[model samples]
Target: MRYLKYFILVLPIVIALEAQAQEEDCAFKLREAQQLYDAGRIETIPEMLQACLERGFTQEDRLAAFKLIILCQIYADDLEKAHAGMLSFLKRYPEYELTTTDPVEFRFIFEKYRTRPILDIGAFAGVSLTHGLISQPFTPFNLNNAKPKYTSDGFGFQAGALFNFYASSNIQISLEPMYAQSNFQLVYEQEPIEGIATLDHHEKQSYLYIPLSGTYEFIIGKFRPYARLGFQLGLLFANNTSSSGIFEGPDEDNLENRNQLNYWVFGGGGFKYKLNKSYIFVDLRYNVGLNQYLVSPDKRFTQPNHNWVYMYQDSDFRLNSFMISVGYARSFFNPKRVN
Candidate 1:
């Protein structure tokens, strides 16, 4: 009985000693990490902190390391990475704090409401601009306008459904089919026909772009952001009846008059939300032209120069995009258990 009582008494002392040893070791490692940091040997700090974590440090230890990591990231001028790290740390140790310093208030502002769902589905309709070869002014067979201008900005209309299949809590696959139109007009802008800029006669061209893309998303609950890589196969649907007239020149100075279905790279990101099992979501994307529209050389009717350069100005390649459509999301996933 006496030995049994002694064993219990010694066991607690042993446990207390082991815990004290572990804390001392953790403090030692943190000091080492800070020394390395002061000496600008920063790459070794995470490794050191990770080692301490492997040894089961106190919550305070972990929190202090995280806060220091934030300061380090700030000094490194990597705001995006720093913000992401701060957010992630708060997720794992929501209440961790240090004895010497008060926790930053901003660190936990929206934490409780930040975590969100993994899958989403929805449909949306918005305006788009076909920054493609087909001009818009000559569209609808501009039997009216006789001139086109660079300022002949066009409009696009689109409607489609999108689905997000989250591969992981943090990664997702996106699939969507959207019907869209690119319409624009070619006209003379500043250099007027008689030294005056007017909405002169314009020719419009119209086409449809059906893009198939795969996207990788980086998720932080309701804030599901992503990057996409996809190809758009465009189809020529309408053009100016004036194509055979003023536009039908050699495929040189005027490719807009002779544009065909083309392809481009599509990529962009947006925020997401959930409404129920059947959620609606929104995202913004941009089409970057990969093919040259106008084959004209800057030699102005001269032969191709020795330098095989792309005619960007001749192609008039600019970003074509959609707006708030990027973040307007409505997901309807029956959250199994959000709390």
Candidate 2:
């Protein structure tokens, strides 16, 4: 039993030492292959590096090996193998950018292939500020005698995923599906039979939204700045309201008098910082509501309990929102010829 315990502890160290030895052997072989290439032994270079390229080379070592092998095939007048080698190099390192130190022949071969991302899918979470655009005011009491004010009183949160399909190097079409929550407050003073009373009402709503957009991106160094224009469709899934001051009660579900479908048009711009094969991005957007959020006028007061017990009537308003979000995305690429 003691020997078994010791074996378990020693097993990992043994495997790690073996891996280190293999890596060192591969590194020595790679250096030898480079020297052979420099000495004009181009024909033997492929066989010299084949074993390490298949197994023990690290990521950086692998890139250097592929570059060296492709150059050797080019020098040997093996154009078919050279082209195939370039294709495999691109597939392995899709985000690689050519440097000035690269040979002119390498640049020529790289230019013959397209290595842009085919699609990028990611998720994001953020906060939003919502403003109500009131077209008409509603009150259980006489509007002539009382004044009501509506304000965005709280921050809302949202989370969603984006599906970005690239049409070209700088153009893409995107679909974003999100679940969002928002809040607003209403305050008013009314003259009751005995005295004046002040009331405050807070409403919270949750929705499912899908926005389809077209994006134009500017590739500037590692920062990609982009602008998007889109229209969104939203379905209200939950609505709850609570009141304070003179008329106060437990929170009540208020989805009955609210419109379920919301239409919006939004535009925004942001930048992304490339990190390896993934990107970290920040986005800002403003959504303009196309229609009122309340039900039709005749149906607004259909719930007698809402008016008599709660003494609350929803105002006819459109919701506009400004949102900021940060997210990460991984790009998938298909390397091929432009033709």
Candidate 3:
């Protein structure tokens, strides 16, 4: 009789522990799916999560698992699977509402699948025209009071995605996250004492950039003219500097003249030609740098003024660029007009 009573007391505890362990297992599986998705393993997620979605122990786990599967399918370019998954999700959770925490891309796709709007997701690539401006102390070593000089023009290219959010008939917000290859040339000229008179330096840099702009449109027949005002941020990734003449030393890599980060305020006007739901655009913009491009060193050079070029130098230099780009994009979501 005493053993029977003990058995009765332990049975409920064992059952509860088993249930808890099952719940934990389900949570772990869902987390694993999320990890794979976040790690850019889009193609692997569907297979890895099939079992979890089929056997989800709770409503939250099933919902999360389904969403992951649908997202993975969309990224993998399997639109048919994505559409089917989304339909199934809606059928399962008819009252579920999307939150702000969800990925904007996913929300955009879902809205397109439901109620369409004038939304665009586009990719663009174009050439760039950059003019570098360097400002120093006007001959810090009192060489001649000559201002810093730059190349006439350096050429590069930029590529990125353009997401256009149309608010109304005459207004839209265009956000572009891009990668740019910017190259520049700097020249330091001195008295022609020898063959090595001018120090010509060329720098090639890579940056990740994003430009957010508010645009206004004026329709004229088939062409739409628009103007935009915005700011851009550029994060430098890699820099390579090469020199010739007097500036050429054993160390060709000079970290002293490079800036790791840069930003600019920009404005421009452009025109677009409409063709059904797709359009081609050409934009011309000017960018002005807001900060110094070089860092000042702590140590000073006590050597002769001629050797001053090798020492740490400070300058008030800024970047400016005139860019002309042309690309095409399509409107994927166009909402119905209410009359």
Candidate 4:
């Protein structure tokens, strides 16, 4: 009884001491990784961070550790892991960036995701250029032009992500959701008018795009060839920034009545290749809009006194793009901070 009492009393103290020791070790490791990164010695930071991760730190520690890992991955020129990492993180923590106080730091992480090993991500800063073949019909042009139902060029920007379950290195089942914005002018004229009424306009669409695709990848050394079949779900985000009404010209009117979102079905395919620690990616996809720009009851989908959103729901915006996104990624664990 006496021995048991003494053992019990000492065990808590011993355990507490051991825990403190482990925490100090993790703190030391994290500091070391940050220092090395600050010093621009990136390659070794991962190793050190991984050591700390393996030591089983708290959740906050793990989060910080992953951030370091991501930076190391970017510096090391590993894109495959970067893309996969972005997808994984966003899916798990979609609004993690929104919750942070330091948006600039968060942006650094995003810029890291957008940058390529061969090309700077900053080059594609505002616009991400892309090209993909249409395996499915993604064209949203009106055989007849109305308010929002019309055609432009075949290329713009597919600025969202496509999801896929990789069955294997060469095969994956895909569910890709993307978003894009396009600014263009619109012309509207009633087919049978008493005299002649014409309207010239400009508008933009923010689409909530979703595509269901099956991707078949062919691996030849570092080269990858893939195919896809899917459609897009477009949601309207905004309308004409500046426009003219039916009675005036571009400089003479404000046409807020002609904004809408549209949906469509389209498909395509493309190829990608890998580099030492990065990748080069490209694709060509087509968009086919299924609905009209505005229904019959509302010409231009306009209201007597306000914007179109309050009058009626907007259809999917008729906008598609040929997209190219490049990414790099790597895995790391580091206990020393290097610059």
Candidate 5:
């Protein structure tokens, strides 16, 4: 039992030492291969480094090995093998960009391939500030003596995933499926038969939103600034209403007679900061509702509690919002020659 314990403790150290020794051997072999290449002995370089290239070398060492082998094949007039090696290198490091120190022959071969982003998958969470645009105002209690006002009450939250497809270097078409919540408040002074009073009503709603947009990007160094225009389709799934002040009612489920599906047109601009093949971005957008009327006029007085207890009625209005979000995205690429 004691021996078994000792063996367990020593096993990891033994494996680590063996790994270190193997790494040192691979490093020595790489240096030897480089020296052979310089001395005009390119014939044996590929065979000498094949084993280390497979598993023994670190990432940096593997890059050097691949470069050396490709250059060797190029010098030997083995253009087919050289091209194959370049393809492998690109598959291993898709985000690699050209540097001045690279050989002209390498640059020529690299230029033959295209490595643009094919897709980007990302997620974002943010806040929405919503306001109601009233087309017709209505009040059941005060027909002429009092006026009503609608205002955005508080911030609502939203989160979603982004599926962006690249059409070209500068254009991307994106579909965003999101879950969003919106809130607004209604306030008015009431002149009932007894005296003057104030009433307040707040509504909260949840929706499933799908937006399709096309974005144009201005690429400048590591910063990419972009503008997008799109339309969105939304389905209202849940809603709640609360009344307070002069006439207070219990919180009520208010989904009845509400428009289930809504449409919107939006425009926005933002920028992305690149990190290798990933990015951090900030986006700002404004959405305008296309459906002018949110509540059906025929069903306005159907909810008895809203009329008698809250002393309220539905107004013909549209919802508009401004949103700001921060997110991260990972890009994928398919490198191939444009034929």
Candidate 6:
């Protein structure tokens, strides 16, 4: 009877020691998960601590585990689970504050999914430079005498809006629609033919430009630098030209019609700075045309008296330009959340 009473007294103490050991083990597992996450071994944490998260952790440790799981989901591209985890977090701790040690990736996902949209809108305005290229027709037994010259300072203006779609943290696609006015001066250089000297002319054009581009960006703090490449389609709305002091209007008013459809490939780089929920950006770009322009036979200075037998003639003349612009943009989200 005396030994039986001693056994009963020691049983509760032994049970308490075993419970303490189990709790210590759970804490160790939680700490290990955190270390793995900090070391960028996110793929390993779920396999290692998923069971411990459900088994023996305290309330504080459980909260930390859930936060880590959310982060892991984001990194793993498991957005659906990350969103659900965020909902759970908000329900449990409605007033939780993010600390400085939080990862930037986490903040980006949280802000976008919780408050902003995947699309951004941008606006800009800047100067443009237009260059005209002229080449001789390929033929046998022909002299390369007729040369078309252009003024080097063909300055212009451009203004536009950029519709940006975010594909990832470092990449986006932009569709820009803009209006531009360009100016140029044309000169013909050739040896004196029939006592005629060189001729000078002027041209001014207005176009609607549409461009689609892909951008890759590098982010540092509130500033971002990006490179973009794209193709643009231009539709001529108005064109006016004067040769040897005689004036000729566009297709609508002139006897011969000029090429109204222009397409080219463009590339550029720029920088963006964050301002509240909006961004301010600056861009510079160059465009190269693929097709030549068709000039009117009546205005061909090389054969000045050439009758208008044909309205348009194919010439090895192309258009190239440079552009720079500045703009502002902001993000929007649906299902608005209360701040």
User: Compared to the true structure, candidate 5 yields what TM-score?
Assistant: 0.85
Per-residue lDDT of candidate 4, residues 1-339 (tens digit)? 999999999999999989889888888888888888889988877677676565556667867777767766766778555455555544434324334553354455554432211111211112332222222221122324333333342234545543445454466565555566655543333331224433333445556656666667776666778887766666665554343333432332223343344566767777766554334566666555565444332443344322322221234343344445443322111111111
Q: Note each model's CA RMSD in angstroms.
A: 18.8, 3.2, 17.3, 17.8, 3.2, 17.2
Give the Cα RMSD of candidate 2.
3.2
Compute each candidate's TM-score over C-alphas.
0.42, 0.86, 0.57, 0.41, 0.85, 0.58
- lDDT scores of the candidates, listed in order: 0.52, 0.86, 0.69, 0.50, 0.86, 0.70
**How far off is residue 104 in model 3, in Å?**
39
Clashes of 3: 1
Q: Write the per-residue lDDT of candidate 3 for residues 241-294, one digit (tens) a residue.
A: 655454455434444445667889999989989765668999888888887666
Instruction: Return model 6's CA RMSD, one decimal.
Output: 17.2
Question: Candidate 3: where are CA atoms >4 Å away?
Answer: 1-117, 134-145, 188-196, 247-257, 296-314, 336-339
Order of candidate numbers by TM-score, starting with the best: 2, 5, 6, 3, 1, 4
Error of 4 at 79 (Å): 36
What tens digits encode model 1's per-residue C-alpha lDDT throughout 107-133? 432232233345566667777765434
- Count of steric clashes across candidates, in order: 38, 0, 1, 66, 0, 0
Per-residue lDDT of 31 in model 5: 98
Question: Over 4 Å off in model 5, which ranges?
Answer: 140-147, 188-195, 218-224, 273-277, 301-304, 307-309
- lDDT per residue, candidate 6, 1-339, as tens digits? 999999999999998888778778878988988888888889877666667666676778877887888899898999877777776665554434467877786665555433334688878899988877767432111236644455544679999888998776578889999999887765445532325433345567888999999999997767889999999998887876544422232222321345688889999999999776678999999988766655443344443222122112224567888899999998653422333
Give the residue spans of candidate 1 off by over 4 A. Answer: 1-121, 130-152, 163-165, 195-206, 241-257, 294-339
Write model 5 residue lDDT over 63-153, tens digit each, in one string.
8898899889999999889888888888888877778888888878888887778999999989999888878887785656655666788
Q: After superposing candidate 4 on the true structure, give the runs of residues whose Cα lies further than 4 Å from its correct spot.
A: 1-149, 153-158, 187-199, 245-261, 276-278, 295-339
- True-vs-predicted CA distance for residue 238, candidate 3, Å: 1.0
Per-residue lDDT of model 2, residues 170-262, tens digit only:
999988899999988876554432253556678899999998999999998899999989999999999998875455688889887788999
